[model samples]
Target chain A: MLGPGDDAAVLRAPDGRVVVTTDLLLEGRHFRRDWSSAYDIGRKAAAQNLADVAAMGADPTALVVGLGLPADLPAEWLDGLTDGFGDECALVGASVAGGDITRSEQIVLGVTALGDLGGRAPVTRSGARPGDVVAIAGRLGYAAAGLALLLAGRTGEAFQELTDAHRRPRPPYACGPGAAVLGATAMADVSDGLVQDLGHIAAAGGVRVEVDPDALEVPAELTAAAAELGEDPLRWVLTGGEDHALVASYPAGVRLPPEWRVIGRVTDGEGVQVTGRVEARGGWDHFRD
Target chain B: MLGPGDDAAVLRAPDGRVVVTTDLLLEGRHFRRDWSSAYDIGRKAAAQNLADVAAMGADPTALVVGLGLPADLPAEWLDGLTDGFGDECALVGASVAGGDITRSEQIVLGVTALGDLGGRAPVTRSGARPGDVVAIAGRLGYAAAGLALLLAGRTGEAFQELTDAHRRPRPPYACGPGAAVLGATAMADVSDGLVQDLGHIAAAGGVRVEVDPDALEVPAELTAAAAELGEDPLRWVLTGGEDHALVASYPAGVRLPPEWRVIGRVTDGEGVQVTGRVEARGGWDHFRD
Candidate 1:
C-alpha cells in the first residue's frame, strides 16, 4: 500500500478488481455551518460514500477527498474535519490516502472512495429475482425524524437521539458484504426514502417489491417526535433520506442474520409497493422539492 | 468493467493494484465562465487530474467526477462540458465511470482519476538518485504566457496557440507510462511552476536538481509575448504553473524517448538550482501569494 508522499496513492486489489464511488457536498445545500459541526460534516460525508461502496458489497479501502474551503475558515474546523474523516475511516479499516484542498467561497467537499470485491461477485441492484425476501439492516426513519426536529426549532435533550441520527446516520457497514456472502440477490443503501430507494432495485430488476408496513417497527422516539411536530412518524420511515440503512433482497427461505429484519417481498411485475396506511412521498430529490 | 447505474463502478485492475489522485477546481479561483468555455473547463479539470495519474507512471483507466452547478446554468453548457469529459477520456481510453452532481451557487468541479501501473513500480518523487538525467516531455511556460495575454486583453489570432495552451493543456499522456518503461527514476507533473515542482522531487529524493536554462527552449511565441509584456520569458519557463508537463529523472546514459529533452542532472546536494538569470518563484501555492 503506497501512501501520501507520491503524486498518486497505490492500493492493492487482490482480486484484480476495484470499486469506486464519489459524492459532492456543498455548503447551504448539504449542510449549514450553524447546524452541523465540521467534524459531523466530515463523518457524514465519509459515511455516505463508504455506505455506497458497502452497497456494492465491497470493502472500502481508501478515500481521496477534494475540499473547497473558505479563505477565512478556522484551522480548528479543518482539524475537526480531518479527525472526523479519520474516525469514520477507522470504522471500516479505510484511510484518507490522498486529497486536494483549495480556497473557495464556501465549504465544498468532494470525496471519492475505492473498494475491493475480494473475488466475490458484486451484488448489484438488478440481481433481485422474484420470490426473494426483502430485508433491512439498520435505522430507517430516525434520521428523517431528527431532520424534522431540527427544522421545527425543537432541539431538546429528550430528542437528542433523533437529532444525532440526523447529524450522522449510522449505516450498517458490514451488513453489505455479509449479505453478499449470504447470496443476496440485490442490495441498496437507503440514502433516499425507503420506497424510492427500493424502487431503484425494482426498476433495475424488473420485479415488483411489496413492503409489509406491519413489519416495519417505527421507534417510539420517532413516534413521540412526530407527535410533537404534528407529523406522522410512519411517513418519515417511508420517505426519510440519509438514514444509510442497508436494504437487500435475499432468496426466499434463506435464513437471514440477526441484524436483518424481513420487511418486504419480491414478486412478479414492476415498481415498488408499500402496502399500508402511510402515504408515500417518495424520497429526497435535490433538483426537485 | 461495470458501468454507471450501479452504486459503485467496478474496474479491472489487471496488476492487482490501483493508482488514484484527486483535484478540486473552483469557479472563480480556477476558471472564469466568461474567459473559458464549459468544454474547456471540463477538459482542463480532467487533464489536471489525469496528468497526476500519469505522473505516477500509470496508464489512466477511468475518471469519477463530482460537479456542483448553479441552477441557472445553461443546458448547452452542461452538454458541452460532458462532451469535453468524454473527448478527454477518449485520449487515454478512459471513461467517466461515475459521479454525483448537486446544486450550488457556483460551478465547483471535483475530479478523481484512477490508473493501472501495469506491473511497473510507481515512479515516485523520492526515487531520483544522484547522477540521474533530468528531462522534460511537454510544453513549458506557454500557459503562463497565455494567462498574461488574457489578463492584458491581448487575445488575437496571432496568439491563438498560446491562449489554447492555457485553456486546454495537451499533456503527453502516453509519455508518462512510456517514461516508466524507459526506467524513469523519478517523475512529477509540472502543475505548479517547473522549478518549484522539481524542488519537490529534490526534497523527496534528497538530491540536488540542476536545470540548464540554455537547454530549455522558450517558444518564440512566449518570447514575443514576454517582450510585449516587458516580462522575462525565462522566468515564465522556470516558474509558470498549469502547463501539466511531465518532468522526470532517468538513469545516467539511459536512452529517453524522442519527446524528452535533456534539461539538467541530479547531484548529491538538495533542492532545485536553475543556472541562469531568471528568478524562481518556486511554484503555485494555493495558501500563499
Candidate 2:
C-alpha cells in the first residue's frame, strides 16, 4: 500500500508470502535506442519481470526499478520510460512502487517485480509429471521475428507488427495465476529460446517434453515474412525467445482455459523433442537444416 | 522460503506486508574497480539497500540482484561478489533470493531488498512531532573522511581504517525496528548528507530540526586526518553521506538503546537548523566560512 518518496515502499502480501524476481536489460545487449523508444524498452523490461512473477503463479503486485542512465541522455526519454512503466503496470493492476537511478555509460535497467500467492501454492519449474499436458498462453516467436525484421532493415509499415513485438511484448499476465488456480504442475516464462527454456523445465522436472507442431498454427504473417526472408516460420515457432509467454504442464485430465493451447506433452525422459520437426542435421540442434 | 532456480522466489512476509527498496550502482559513478574489490562493492551495495529496508522499521528477509557485467570481467571477481553478498545476508539471517545477469559495457549492480515489519507500524520520516528528540545509530563522517583520503592519494597503512570505512560501511540494521519499538516518531537512513537527509525528515514532518553541534563528537581519526588535509572535521560530521546510520526522532521521554546518541531535536518551525552554530555569513548555507 505504501508508495515512493519513502526509504522503502511496503506492499501488502495478503497470503503471508511474497514472490520476487529480477531481470537486467543492457543498452546494446537487450535493446537498441535506434530500434526501440525508451517507452518501449521500459515496457519490455517490466513485462519480462512481471511475467516471471506470473509464472510463479502469483498475482503481480509491484515493481521496483534500478536504472542506469548516461548524463547526456534527454529528460523526455526518462519521462517516456516512466509513462511506459506505469502503463504496463496499469495493464495488470500493479504499480511502480520505488526506484533508484545512477549515471552510467549506457542505459541499463534492473527491474524487480513482486507478487502475492493469494493462498495458492506457487507453480515451480520442477513439478511437471510424466502424464501432464504442456500448454502455453500468449504469443510465441513474435518478438524474435520482430527482432529479425528490424535487423534486416525492414522496419517499414508492412513490418510494423513484428517490429512492435520486439520493442514491447504483451505478456499474458493473468494466465499465470489462472493456470495456478487450475492446478498447473509446472510453469515457466518463455524468455529464453523456447527449446532452451523448455529444456530447463525438462531437466528440473526430470521429464522429457515432446512438442506437437500440429497444435501450433504458423500465423499467416509469420509465413509471409518467412517466405520473403527465406526463413522457416515453424523454426521461429519452435526456438525463438523473448515472447514472455507462459508455459505450463497441467494434469492430462484437467481442462485448460480458452486462451491456453496444448502444444506439447510431458513424457518419461529428458531433453526437448519436437515431433514432426526433426532437425538433427542442423548446426544448432533446434534450428532448421 | 523459496530459493532461486524457480520462476520467482517465495519469501514469507509474516506481518502480511513486505518492505521493498532498490538501488543502482554503476561502475564509474558509484564505485571504481581500482579502488574497491568486487567483494567490497557487493557488500556496500547490499548494505546500503538493506539499511534502507531497516530504516522502514523492518528486518531484511531477502535480496534479488540484477547484475550487468562486462564480458572481460574475471570469473573470480563474480565469485567474490557472490560470496560477499551471501556473507552479508548471513549476518542478518537473510539470503540471496534470485538474480539476473546481462552483458554490459561496464559493471552495473541493481539490488532490491525486501524486509518484514513484524506487525510494527513502519516508522516513516513524516511522523516527527515538535517535542521529539533526534538520535542516531551507527557511524557518522567516517566514510566521507575516508573517501577524501583516498581521493588525495593517501591510502597508506596509517589510513587503512578510514579507507576501509569508505570501502565498506557497517550499518546498524537492528536499530530501525528497535527504534520503532521504543517509539520513534520519524526515521530515515542517513544516506545523503546528514543535514540534507534531515531536511527531508523536516520537510516531510513539517517541523524544524535543530541539530545540536555538541552532540556530534568529531572522531579523533577524523580530526587528525582533517588537520593533515587542511579540512574541517566537523563539516564532514554535519553533512557527509553514505554512513547508512539510522537517524530517528523519538518522544523526549523515551529511552534509546545504548547504540543511539541523542544529536538533535524537533522544533516549531521548518527547515534544518544547527544549534550553537550559525552560518548566516557563508555564501551558501550550512557551511562555515
Model 1 stretches with alpha carbons more than 4 Å out? A278-289, B278-289
Q: Report the lDDT tens digits of candidate 1 across residue range A93-158.
A: 999999998988889999999999988899899988999999999999998898889999998999
Residue B38 deviation, candidate 2, in Å?
1.5
* Poorest 10 consecutive residues by lDDT, candidate 2 chain A: A279-288
* Highest-scoring model, lDDT: 1
lDDT per residue for candidate 2 within A1-289, as digits (tens), equals: 8889999999999999999999888888888999999898889889988999999999999999988888999999999999999889989899999998887778888899999999999999999999999999999888888888988888888878888998999899999999999999999999876777788888899999988888986888788778877888877777778889989999998998799999989999887878866522122354443
lDDT of each: 0.89, 0.88
All candidates: CA RMSD in angstroms?
2.3, 2.1
The CAPRI-style docking tier of model 2 reads high
Query: Global CA lDDT of candidate 2, please?
Result: 0.88
Q: Candidate 2: where are CA atoms >4 Å away?
A: A279-289, B278-289
> Model 2 clash pairs?
none
